[model samples]
Target: MTETLARLNATYTEHVIEDFQKKRVPVEIPLCLKEDRIAYGHNLEISYPLKEVLDVSYRYEPGKIGFLYIHTIQGVRTFQINSDPAGFVEQFHQLDHL
Candidate 1:
């Protein structure tokens, strides 16, 4: 098993069935960094390996929430975060040497 290096909260879109209707809702989930991958969701349902990650960045306005972007071979995945992800990005870079 890979050791978890860091943990953060991220917003994810989850589909729900309510009153016989399907709806998309934003849910907060745990995002984790491991030795070789970044995992998302409470159960770690989604993951992107370090080798697949092209870049990671955060964008935000002063006194406002920020967005974390993970560029991977598959595509770019974004997460809404309340604070700067500089440490997370730096840690990932240090681990991946990218």
Candidate 2:
């Protein structure tokens, strides 16, 4: 993550992983939960009863880059990383531009 994104999260509210209107590769941007500075790689998860991860680390590899956020819903948050990071970003942008 860039410093800008980190800063943005700090100065805002809960970042939402929003679904695009055209609905291709969904892209989500996390916002701050409060107007406080959220540090890099800070863990912020929510729970109703059973405590679990609401978001995981966003990984970036030579061929792939992705943010994995897990929820109690289990199957709902399960997916595969079948492409490189550049490819993934391009594909997502293409879907958004469509």
Candidate 3:
């Protein structure tokens, strides 16, 4: 069963797979957390399963935008959103442990 937990603004960075194998492509897309997968991108949607998420990392700087890194099957995908990293981590942990 898939359920959307949150939708946030994301920045595609590092080793995220994109159609046509674009490099350093920057685009603002809606990132959604679902029960089964995380959905991202605009025209080219990328979905990563929750079970494939090997690690979750967060960085918060006073004057800079916060980042959330999700290490999944496709590699590390980054995000810059207004939501709290701690809250996201908490939710992720709960869902992972379930």
Taking the tens digit of each residue's C-alpha lDDT, what string does model 1 give over 1-98? 79998877877678999999999998888888888899987799889988898888889675787899999988999899876677788888788435
- Order by lDDT, highest first: 1, 3, 2
TM-score to true structure, per model: 0.80, 0.23, 0.65
lDDT of 2 by residue, 1-98 (tens): 31222211211134445564333343333322222222222444422112322332234454544333224335323223323334333322232221
Q: Which candidate ranks first by TM-score, i.e. highest?
A: 1
| TM-score, ranked from best to worst | 1, 3, 2
Once fitted onto the true fold, the runs of candidate 3 whose alpha carbons sit more than 4 angstroms away are: 12-26
How much lDDT does each candidate structure score? Answer: 0.84, 0.30, 0.71
lDDT of 2 at 74: 52
For every model in order, what is the number of clashing pairs?
A: 0, 10, 0
How large is the C-alpha RMSD of every model relative to the true structure?
2.2, 14.4, 5.9
Clashing pairs for model 3 are: none
- The model with the greater lDDT, 2 or 3, is 3
- Per-residue lDDT, model 2, residue 55, is 33
Residue pairs clashing in model 2 are: 13-31, 13-32, 13-33, 14-32, 15-30, 15-31, 63-84, 63-85, 64-85, 65-85
What's the distance in Å from true for residue 44, model 3?
Answer: 7.9
